[model samples]
Target: MLELHLNFCNLVEIPDAIGNLHFLEILNLMGNNFSTLPSLKELSKLQLLNLKDCRQLKYLPNLPSRTDLSSKRSLPESFSSKKDPWAFERFYDYMEAGLNTFGCPELIELERCTSTALSWTLQILLQVHYQYILPSLWNIPFPSIISSIIGGSEIPSWFNNHREGMGSIITIDESPLMHKGNNCIALACCVVFGPPASRRKAPPIIHSLNHVSVPFLCAEDRITEDHLWWFYVTSGSHIWSTKYENLKLQFHIIRESDIESWSFHGKKYGYRWVYEKDLEESNLTMICSR
Candidate 1:
């Protein structure tokens, strides 16, 4: 077959029998929860495979042999200079085409710096480059200036040889940030620095509507009533209150359209009567760019 479209269906996995179609050139498996795919070693003619929006997919298996080292016709000439014949540009083009053809939502472009960092992280994880960077974090001495900024206690010596330290350094097993009965809690710490003169300066000011209990959900998990929510006014400055002492807060300005009303200590803050017009105007500009 020249093309096969399987979109918006609740498929949990691909059937191994698909490999029987040796002439199959394109297969779209979008909008599914498939965590794994069947081997396609027999489909020598396969040219494209789409797995867009397969959020649960954590790992991809090795490509089949016919498409591997022994292939007579190689990847495009543009990708020949790279160590791996299958260069990233080609993969990204294929991915984008697949997503568009398979009815995936349009990609949103964020701020340049934020998008660049996110793309780098995704590329590193996908290419398995964790082996090179993870260990170096452990080589840095504990109680160092960098560690203290991100609230890390100390660096371990074992990480000097291995680079896959993502799991080791971000352990939340005994962390106070984890809530009881919520085994899904995870913690990630990173140190972000601005100019040298502003190294110790506080972060931006963020004002929350009220003290509300909010649930923090993991990206992999589904939204549920079990989630809790907590709200507080936070900024980068060091502040002490008898109620919330020595808290380090970072502020984020979400759109006012997303918020319902302001609440402080379980009482309504009456923000609607005061800041509604200005908040709405700001929301319009901020939401569109993001």
Candidate 2:
């Protein structure tokens, strides 16, 4: 019964020696610097793996034959792919329509957004191992899911709209806002790898309000509130200015001055930044409500 708690140590890589802990039951390696995970095929008794902010990690290794992969349950839909036998082809088609030109933008914009989104997804799965497996393992393998989501297969309609809108306006090029004020654009994409929720609400709203100014973008009125939230704001962006109605929030902001260079981790790619603001606001409510 070997239990490991290696949280928040800023480790850059998983040691191959971890495979020796065959009796290991729990491993909490959250908040580390590890970009890739060590092989766990030898640890048949392993149970829980917590990798909350191992942001550097990009890919997961193949699991042992008996390992249950669905423990985390809420795998992002984007990770679902067609190449797999369980590939939700219909779902993929719908998502593609939602994000593609027939679905959202012109061909160029669709391609660009899809490419960037896929790149990010691959980067996340490169170094880790599937901690848990879903009861209903998709005929498709995990690697395929990573490829589909990142490559630009259709996602939920909300995501398509959000991606299209953002792709139309934002470019990878440095923005003026980054130079004048402390601001950067962070793009996040998650692919639920489990069963769909029975009663899911619309996707969260992505908002970017000029932090330096006032008048606050009300939650109900903000354009991003209804669809997949993809926000691009400067360092001056603020959430307090908006009206919130009981939502769990997590955010990370990176500015132009902060980034040093682009690098690769596993199949994923990452850009290093000098500064980043990461925050998680739980049970968020509007100030007016109070």
Residue-by-residue lDDT tens digits, candidate 1, 89-153:
33333222111111122222213212222222222222221121222334311111100111011
Residue 138 CA displacement from its true place in model 1, Å: 54
Q: What is the lDDT of residue 233 in candidate 2?
A: 27
List residue ranges in candidate 1 displaced over 4 A. 68-290
The reply for model 2, stretches above 4 Å from the true place, is 68-290
Most accurate candidate by TM-score? 2
Q: Estimate each model's TM-score.
A: 0.26, 0.28
TM-score of 2: 0.28
